[model samples]
Target: MINWLQHAPVYPIVVPLIAGAAMLLLADKHRILRASISVLAALAQLAAAITLLALAAGAGDIWPKGVGVYLLGDWAAPFGIVLAVDRLSAVMLTLTAVLGVASLFYSLARWDRLGVHFHSLFQFLLMGLNGAFLTGDLFNLFVFFEILLAASYGLILHGSGVARVSAGLQYIAVNLVASFLLLISIALIYGVTGTLNLADLAVRAGTLGGTDRLLFEIGAAVLGVAFLVKAGAWPMNFWLVRGYSSASAPVAAIFSIMTKVGIYALLRIGSLLLPTGAPAAFSLEWMFVIGMATLIFGAIGLLATQQLDQLVSYCVIVSAGTLLTALGMPGVRLTGPALFYLVSSVLTTGAFFMLVELVERTQTFGANVLAVTLDLFDLDDPESPNRSDDVVGVAIPAAMAFLGLAFVSCALLVTGLPPLSGFVAKFSLLSAAVAEANASMQPADAWILVAGVLVAGLAGIIAFGRAGMRIFWGNDERTTPRLRVLEAGPVSILLLLCVALAAGAGPVSAYLDAAARSLDDPSLYIDAVLSASPTRAIGGH
Candidate 1:
């Protein structure tokens, strides 16, 4: 049992799964109890992640295949599902835990007001996220994705306002189509490869020739489409803005992590499931183009929107687009920066979403009083100084100013602005793209990276400008006060996280670089999987 505990990476997956269920059952009617358990569970997961990362970082040879593949109930690998915690999955699981804890903290005060089942749904959502990142089998990845989508369905529409419900339906509809296609893609891959274990599939894929290659590549493309859709890339991201705009702040904050999950899956499978001599050099380029397009589209949409939440939602789309564009660059080269940008974007965007909620509540005033005082600012009045009375509020002015700072920071990060980590990440990708071009002596790839950066930057500026104006300047009418400490505390903490990421980019960069290197060497992962004796079974890292 001790040997199994040491070899098995199952704790990462099991911790969340068990915590989620226990949170639901044990919370009872006391909101404080639920919040305490939820926060503790999330921290426990984070602690475990820190330990796992420390262990991996310390050892030269941590993973061994047989031991890493912990079969549930002591079943063998081929018949039973396995959880693979390669470097990529490990980083992502830790990310989920961090973001999950933040979101739960953000929701503590609002949980009771949100509805009876809000806490449960949120935990379940985390469960799905952790599981998806850790699963070794393709089929189980699909299952985890579905679980996430299902939990999001409830969380997204938790308040169930007319607009929220309508948008949630559209969001679910689009994903349903993509989900079906994803399952079909998996079935095709399983039929062709005769196995679903990612490591085994990677080894076996090399033996295929002719028709088999065609079938696999096509299957890969189909699966790629599903991930692209989830990532909110161009041509399929129309629903992202609407859904995010409608959901409550905490829901939207957590939902931002979902697109990153899609990006992670694409990278994980692209590295592990494809043959080394995989067909088509342009697929990555295609991903880059889609990201560029998303950046432009999101910017345009943000420029047109006046609402605080909607603007933030579109900005998220722009960030996701840029991240995906970076991923589409060729080679094992962009791995470090891509992961860096992804982590930064997730943290920054989550903070911005929370801030938007706070601003919206504080900026708007009571409708009843405003209606009574309408005559004072009536434009038709002969003696009126209406223009002078149009200020939004003191809190809003201060919040908007900070929000603008946040957006500029986001722009700097996303556009690879100088001295910021975003620039560091973009620099890495551009350099790789340039190297790939020089090796092939083709100027087109370099041109693609340049053009993509320009378009994404433009979009970031336009979107932030539009959103900033509405959040700071716009005042159509007044509404009831909704200020709550739980809400502000989370936003403040998230903003601190963003600041920490930017300020400590060097150490952060090293950790991500190490992660990328580990990802490139999958033998370590295989060893981890196979290290355990048969007596102990595992499911995920």
Candidate 2:
């Protein structure tokens, strides 16, 4: 047990990889076996992730320094086959696992049967996500990225509808281009520095001068562009909304974290290897510019969109932009709050994705068309009395009440309204911006950051309000949608978790502040990875 705990960082990648392959070998007819295997693997991964987070948080006896590295012993294995665990990776691992458990359980309700190998593909996807987070080298980073992207392709097109297929194809095309850019950037970095390891690159990158620095900076900029595309920054993220909105609900829910994959890479690589000043190739100012553009673009998209799914998807873009913009603000201690906002926004967007599907189940097709037509034509007279068949404060069925409340909860989360995690998160970010303005933060930049967040929240409120009125309060006669425990249970768990996050913001904020500080200074990670011997496991360090 001690030995296993000592090497726990490897379990997240290995367990899922083994389970996914094993399920693939089992004939497709054995749904029970597949589900059982997948569930156990996911559970094991979650447990391992929690343990690592414990270690990172200074919780367990196995590691005193809250860092661990697992290296492959096989003679044939490349030096790059290394897994490193620290506070940042641990947070992402736990988040991916949490999302995995919820989304997997939700899919088991019915979506798992929609396409072949769902259980296997789902497990494989988890493997990729975990691997991406745990790997210590840029080359392996690309490998794990491709693994996840491939799995996502199948998952996105799982339902096989025309809209889904078309969107998936475009998503694939855009990612393929991004992957090419990533490859080129990797090659450029390797050719110049002769090492793909992040720690080694961090050291060498800092020492480079003259033409070498120019090449490295250009490579980093290209790499940033690649990640920005994945992060769903404007102009490059045209594929995000269409693809995500068309996917199955569970798929979309899990995909809420997909954008963060790029964000994570940027945080890791940019802080470690890329220089951030104005003279450098990839400056923070550029990140802020792109982020604000993406934020404003998403805000407009929220108002322009009529569909619930699309509205939720635009919220994702807004969240990404908000994070990017926050990250760009190094003058302020906004990273901690930005991290808080990331967790809140990701969880809420995921819940929103799942809830939208259930609530839309109550909406009629003709009613939606009628509403759109009325809005476009202005057929109704202004100031005319409007009647709602849905009586105010009337008792609704348990299932419908669940949907309504869940919808409202999701709305609050999206809009950053009071008494929920979203409000707390946005408030924290705004406070950071305002509080730091008198210090290192430029007055104009702080104001823009605050404005950006407020505009996003306002847009969400308007969009969700319009959507809520149309779906829940529409005049068309509606019946309670059929509800399943598996379906509703996941939504409840996520919302409850959000509530808990708010309740426990003090502790959570402390932990995330630690993470932000660690990110602000990459030397801790550099020393931890470089000091470890490849032949032996590094623990308690």
- Give the per-residue lDDT of model 2 (tens digit) for 174-219: 9999999999999998988888888878877777788987888788
Judging by lDDT against the true structure, name the best candidate: 2
- Return the TM-score for candidate 1, rounded to 2 decimals: 0.83
User: Please, what is the whole-model Cα lDDT of each candidate in the order they appear?
Assistant: 0.68, 0.83
State each model's C-alpha RMSD to the native: 7.5, 8.0
Off by over 4 Å in 1: 1-8, 26-28, 59-69, 279-282, 365-440, 473-485, 522-541
lDDT of 1 at 326: 67
TM-score leader: 2
Model 2 stretches astray by more than 4 angstroms = 74-80, 274-281, 366-397, 535-541
